[model samples]
Target: MMKFIGEAMNETMKRNFSECPPFFTPFGDTHKCISLFTPIKVSWFEARMFCESMTGNLAILDDINTYIQLLKYIEEKVCNCVNSKINKQCEDNERKLMPRFTGDAETCLSILEENFYYFSDEWCTVKLSPLCMTNKI
Candidate 1:
């Protein structure tokens, strides 16, 4: 089925790009890899294109549970980066989660400071890290 294909693709991706850790969650049968942020900030369109180049797309919170899980994942990842004894890379990259570009026409989703989900139909012009996702192939 598609899940098997997605898993195979993910395995291949992990083998090829070991540096970027993909996020996986049992919610919604999510076996996708997500790039929380790109090395450089880019516009929403550019961010979507970048993800597409990687055989992925802009992440979408299909439901409330998925959104909750995604928020938790981001928080855990940030905490780990902060606790990591590695270089200052984590501290340097620590930033508010950008209101990610969703597939919804013109509307984007943003997690507020208190971990609440909000959406707007207005266009976003600011450059920020893109949250990308590779769904079931």
Candidate 2:
């Protein structure tokens, strides 16, 4: 059942990408396009792969402004479920130094619901929805 769901997600995403252009929003000094693959959760690595397949990568909130804008965007465009955690990109050293990090070797960054939707270090193997982004569009 999980494999079927995953396959269905990939097919849906591919069709969506081919039919509709991604909406780009202002991020710092450039425009960024973000896509949240929800209703299906996967590990950090899987999330990254999905984004890569779309010619993008996991979303990276580098500054407060970008973070705020993303939050607003998600609130308005995506579902309002507060229990959802979204995967994002993070550096190895950065994840390790986070206050809540457990010193896990395969930790990654995610927008944690328990952390008030803030960035938190979590095991890379943990399943979560992905927030993909691209600056090229």
> For candidate 2, what is the lDDT?
0.58
10-29 in candidate 2: lDDT tens per residue?
64566435333343233334
Q: What does the lDDT read for residue 73 in candidate 1?
A: 75
Candidate 1, 14-115: lDDT as tens digits: 653433333322223466556565244666777778677766777777778777777777667654666766524556542434445655666555543344
Indicate the residue-level lDDT of 91 in model 1: 65
Candidate 2 Cα deviation (angstroms), residue 103: 8.4
For model 1, give the 10-residue run with minimal summed lDDT: 19-28
RMSD, every candidate, angstroms: 8.0, 9.0
Each candidate's clash count? 0, 0
> How close to the true structure is residue 22 of candidate 2, measured as C-alpha lDDT?
47
lDDT of 1: 0.56
